[model samples]
Target: MMPMTITEIAEAVGGTVTAPFAGEHAGGVPDGEVARSATSDSRLVGEGGVFVAIKGERVDGHDYVAGLGAKGAAAAIVDHAVSDADVTQIVVDDTVEALGALARHNIERRRADAGKPFTLVALTGSVGKTTTKDLLKSLLSTLDETVAPVGSFNNEIGLPLTALTVNADTRYFVAEMGANHVGEIARLTTIAPPDIAIVLKVGVAHLGEFGSVERIAQAKSEIVRGLLPSGTAVLNADDAHVAAMRSIAPADVVWFGIDPAHADEDALTVRELTTDDMDHPSFTLVAANGDTADVRLAIPGAHNAMNALAASTVAHMLGMPLDDIARVLGEQRRISPHRMAVSTVERDGAVFTLIDDSFNANPDSMRAGLDGLARWGAGRKTQPYRVAVLGAMLELGGDEQGLHRSIGAYAAELGLDRIVAVGSATDAEFDALAGALAEGACTAIASRGGTAAVDWVHDADEADRLVTSIASEHPGTVALLKGSHASGLSTLAERWAPADPARR
Candidate 1:
């Protein structure tokens, strides 16, 4: 958000300034110039920033106009009426949409000037986008100054916001793109379109909006569509569905995989797995040119091995040495507080290891979690139960129920000690698991009250209560908490783990 004018913002979003300068207009203010740097929901406003007041299904931003004035907002972009005592205001049909346009405009201005900037890398998928972003940041940071999408800012608004975060000093920009519908990735790609695009894989994530995995792949492939003509596309060679994404790119394609079977087939791959006594994984890194070296992973799971391979491919394409790339990644931290966060829980008699994967889950990630759990839980004997507080995986659309049922069947087949389910899909899962699973290992329809007919997920307390009740009913468990972003299943895991009661 370089400094711009209020009149320019009005031009940008097709909003009109309802009032001229009512408040004291400063002498140095550019005729209509107003600062529209970042989006803010706070009641307080900055001296020059354009404050967008949005209306939701419930709350209206119109109510906060004067409140914005009280906080010295340079100009208020409003949808409804503003009565009295105002600075400057732009009235629009909707503030949220205005905010989106303003963001897109801001990024386009910077990108149009990217002649002086470095190569851009964009990562997208149902799972591991954040982890891959972190890995790229780690590897690229060794090469030059880097800018990355912070946290989970990978949406329509988040994409532009991340682009705005980049400046002239950044040598590399890593953008994490996320979507749930057909046009989101395409829309996001319009901003921060990458020089190098990484697609983790396609699975049942966000299936609600897009309908099927094929549609999801099409939506994600928009990253390539949005790329510069000479950019590279990096893909998951192991994902059968994602195998075709390379064709979508106008430039070169870089391939990465974790399967040793694919290791010799010319794709860059990482193999040679060894789990430590602590059960964390270490592996060998194999480049596309047939070079190989051993590198220990800070992140757990076979999925992360694939993640490292993807990171390695990007680094190799960017001209990093084979050996140096492995060493830097071998010591970097796994994306924090996400899956494989090692923690311990105290029971009546002994300690049980707890691995928190509560950020979010999809079909691909759920299977990865089960495999990781198998590695961690296989040798522990005192484990009373291998617990999974599985919640409704949203966005599967027509396939939601079937996907949940399949996961349930898979969990039972894995011989997990117990399963606790939330969401409507679990009812389908329960029906699938009941006959195939032993009596004690599987449970279903376990929302707040355990009613069979309820279809939605429970609250944090409810999810936590489910965990407590389950633990009380059967103690000494190793719990794996997984669900979609909206699941709030992290609350359940947090409550069960050792936390300040106030925090809980």
Candidate 2:
């Protein structure tokens, strides 16, 4: 981050400096100025960095203002509502809002100074933002040094943090944006707004927070609201939540879908992508200008083939070579920790393979992970069982039970050797599915705990304890462990992976 003056930051956000700490003159700092870039916690205060004393929901950042100032934080930007009598402070209506205002100003200044405005790709969706970002970064890297938002840092605070991470050297910035409400994405767009926006697919995500699917779509369209007037959008033509948003997009739009099954031959992007018998889709990607790229996504699931296509579509538009885009995809498909990361465990002579898709989940992603598990475990017939340990899918609003049952039905249709649906809602659905599924091939066990499947049908818990018992006792099975972030299923994925003693 750079250096900026207290007065300059105050003026930009319509804030007032209530007191003075020291002389404001940034010499060695980065964009830590009022009309300039932001500095860091330890940057020279004399080098002019603005200190935002944010009041978090639980912890007040204002409490650390003096400590930060002592560490060379230039000026303190605080809330007018905060009554700090002795120390120097810049008063704003809301400190967090002021920080956002600072981000917008810095973004605008960057635009003004650049000889050419670099393209911004704002990506958002439930299942594939990080994967999409990885794919996009891979394709774009072939063209130039690209900077993408690290991990899932796409929220209000994260967006600014990501923006500050971007400097003049970044030829392209791929901002991964996320939202759980109607107005959240809109607020994020006001900062790292995009030149091209991709709304991947809205699923039963954050239903626990935002209320409904339609409302989720409405929230995601705020990305469209953030695009430049002449910018373009790449959308999932198959998603009703995404498709219905065309009317709201004020820019050019390109539709991408996985349906080669459709009779319409004139689609923007379409390919005959298919998953393996275990459900990993490998397909060639046909780009915009009749150019075809052989896309082999290391990430399983047909949904990711869709994700790869979304990345390639933008790459095609940007003039990336078809071959370069395909070659680097393997390097780019690095799924961050806890997100569909596959590993193995060696317990005695048995091979305990675990597929960890625990970072987050909705029905769409849960299904996708199941497909991946099937693909990775396709040829392992010697493994005693194909087990699925699934936690409850939260926030389906009023239809949580039905949603869980539907997931169970999907599990039943998959013909796994044993299925354990954990948590109350999903357990009920698993029971419903168990009763409905023909007996002979698969067993469906639903419980609020792992003991039910783990201990002759004990109830309580998500996939956590379910996988534990399955792997510990019967080390000869392919296990698919999944749950939302709240359930912390990544730990289980690690437990089954190599060197953990299970797969020894």
Candidate 3:
């Protein structure tokens, strides 16, 4: 974050400096001291950092204010004072509201100091928001100082924290907007409105929260609506719902997709796309100006091709050459962990290809991960055995059971050799959900009338044991682990892919 004087911070948040300077500078901090960064987590506070005390469900950050002095913190913004601690205090009515105010003030300061306004890019979708953001950040950093959120920090508090990190030197600010309900993205756009807004596909990611697919599309369209009058809207032409956003876009529109029907003079399109044995995609990137470059992504998955096109289109609009964009994308590896991460595991003289896409799951991503596994297994020289370890996909609302059943049936149709459904039916409240998934998968496999085996486990440990046994028996086995965050499938992936001693 850029440096801000203590006096300036208090004024930005409309708070008062009450301690450590009662008589100095009219009860304000000394003018020489500055806050280097802003964070709510006390553990991240440094000597010149500003700590915002927030009240959470399990813990109150006000309790941690007393220890900041020993940590060398510059000041703490809290709802109340801690008389026992020797820390400087900025008293505010609400710390969360103060945080937003401070971040907005910082952004305005950056714009004034930059002399020319910096570009603000906002992106939203049901899936691939993080991967596309990472790609855009990589491509933008080659040309200038870029600031993006770490992981999926795309919500209200997370978005504000990321905005505070920007300074005068930052030329590009990539804000990822996410929503589980309507108006969430609208609120985020008010904090830092986008000069360029990209809307990926609108799918059934948070169906439970929004109640229907139409509502999900309505929520995703808020990003396009929040754009500046002169902003550019980057949209996916293949998605009908996303394509319809052009009518509501306040500025110029740039379309991107693999379908030829969406191609135009100013569209960024893809052609002749194919995935390798490991599911890494390669395609010819054609710019609207007729310039073309072949892009081979290091990341594994056919679905990532669309993500690449989205990032490339944004970069092209920002004055990056087509060749440079393709070159940098080829050199890019996995930035965020647990999203279609491919690794080889050696155990008991057998090698298994592990596709760790267990970070989070919705119906769209679940289908994409399963397709990757099918393609990877089919491309093997010896025709390796295929195994799918799926867990419950939550936030699916009333039709959650039917959705889980359909996913199970789809996995069966993929011709996987084995299916392990991970969940327990022991809990009275969760039994219907878990039981439906397992029963649906088993029933589908039975209908196939093949040698493909299906098992239902109550926990990750049982699923891990079964998967280990399968890998041990079949040397060239390929396995996929996909589920929501609460399913504990990511933990199973970590157990398989332990830290390397050499890296440590």
lDDT of each: 0.67, 0.65, 0.85
For lDDT, the strongest prediction is 3
Query: How would you encode candidate 1's per-residue C-alpha lDDT over 1-504 as one tens digit per residue?
Result: 656677777887788776633445422234655574544454435666566676667876667666554465667777765776365777788766677777667655666675566778988887888888888899999988787876788886566656655555567888999987888888877666678889988877877788777899898888888888998888787888787877778987777877756544446676677775335567877766678888877666766777777888888888888788889887865564656665665544344456678788878898888666655546566544666656656666665666676776566556566566654333554333222222222333221122211112334555455555556666655666777656656665665565421110
Model 2 lDDT per residue over 374-417, tens place:
55545655534677777656665676666666666566555566
List clashing residue pairs in candidate 1.
5-33, 5-34, 6-32, 6-34, 207-395, 208-395, 208-396
Better of 1 and 2 by lDDT: 1
TM-score of each: 0.80, 0.80, 0.94
Clashes per candidate, residues 3 or more apart or on different chains: 7, 37, 0
- The residue pairs in collision within model 3 are none
lDDT for 65 (candidate 1): 65
Better of 2 and 3 by lDDT: 3
Cα error, candidate 2, residue 454 (Å): 8.2
Question: What value of lDDT does candidate 2 attain over all alpha carbons?
Answer: 0.65
Model 2: how far residue 108 lies from native, Å: 0.8
Decoy 1 TM-score against native = 0.80
Superposition error at 503 for model 2 (Å): 15
